[model samples]
Target: MSFIKKRTSHNYDIYESRGHIIGRITLLTGLIFTFLPPLFLWLVYGIMPPSKELINGIISISSVMLPVSIVEILAFSPMLGTNAMYMSYLTGNIANIKLPSAAIALEVAEVKPSTEEGDIIATIAIGGSVIASEIVILIGMLLIVPLSTKLNNPVIQPVFQQILPALFGSIGAYYILKEWKLAIAPLSVAILLNLVGDLPTAVTIPLCILSSILTARLLYKKKLIKVTD
Candidate 1:
């Protein structure tokens, strides 16, 4: 859908932002990085040949990325106007602040309030999707392992593990433009996390959370930041 919003002030707040242009640029770049994950699997495995699967599948998948990149470039793009409208309809009232489509879609579609009938159905649906996805991936592994199993093939794996630096540079460039300090904290924690993943998430989550909070507390205690004081 065209993202050209109407000219009303209310609509402007719904659809416009100061960094709309830059947001589109970085998001498109981010989306390109996001596309690399699945696209790598498709190319490495030759998952779908055009002759059998037809062109529609290509179009369908591309739409998801288009929205990720250009926000409202696709029908389900995270347009604030659309978000406001959906929120107004779904929750029975328009909110003062705009929410992204991702949040509203989750609210309206996935997260149902618990009722007397049961809360188990939602959990079952999530588990069911997980199982179904695993089955599909297992089938792909079976088909592709034999077809493209050359151990020493040139394209088998990247010679230099370049994706890491490239991703970090791209994301770092974007964040450094705005919030370099906020960016550093996550990068610091992620580096620390790489060595600690052997721990269960149940353990790791609390550890990381507690560590970050304690670190923040210590920083605040030194009178470095006034909010905590």
Candidate 2:
């Protein structure tokens, strides 16, 4: 048993090390490709926005996005695992699409996040979702002109808005039911904060994460919740 455990640990370490290397390389490549279009226009046509306007635009966007980005990394990394995080960020639509897919995948696989099995499952799930989304997007593009009228119909607009809320609500309910004690603190904090005033997601996300962590620690300390290996 000891030898088997050691071998498993060795294999997992190698898996994680390779995951990091590949994730970093792909992410850096994606970043370079992301900037290539603007660089092309600037170099080939000498076409670029005014320096002052560009600086202001960047600051305005970065101020909001930087905090949110940092918070998302901290909040989602544990649940997403390293490779899934890199893939989801590279593909975008993480909150609405990739996150829910990963959550559902983990639940179905009966694997806890941040573990070796969970990491592998999540990476595979996210990869599948990315491909599925691309196919859907391609079909949408092909059909968009024909379906434009119906898609833009007032009655259908409300349904589109509710999709994300419904998706998250179902996932939240599942976890909350499974571990209501752990959910209480963060849920209460979120509700109270929202009731007081509408807090930006950047502000609320970190607070919620902190509350959940503290609550879990307190529960474990109190022997209210048992930790399992």
**Which prediction has the highest TM-score against the true structure?**
2
How high is the lDDT of residue 153 in model 2?
93
List the global CA lDDT of all models: 0.45, 0.90
Worst 10 residues of 2 by lDDT: 198-207
TM-score of each: 0.27, 0.85
After superposition, candidate 2 runs with Cα above 4 Å error: 45-47
Superposed Cα RMSD, model 2: 2.4
Scored by lDDT, model 2 comes in at 0.90
How many clashing residue pairs, candidate 2? 0
- The superposed Cα distance between candidate 1 and the true structure at residue 213, in angstroms, equals 5.8
lDDT of 1 by residue, 106-192 (tens): 344544323211122323333344455568778988877676657447785684367667755764565356434334554576667
Pairs that collide in candidate 1 are none
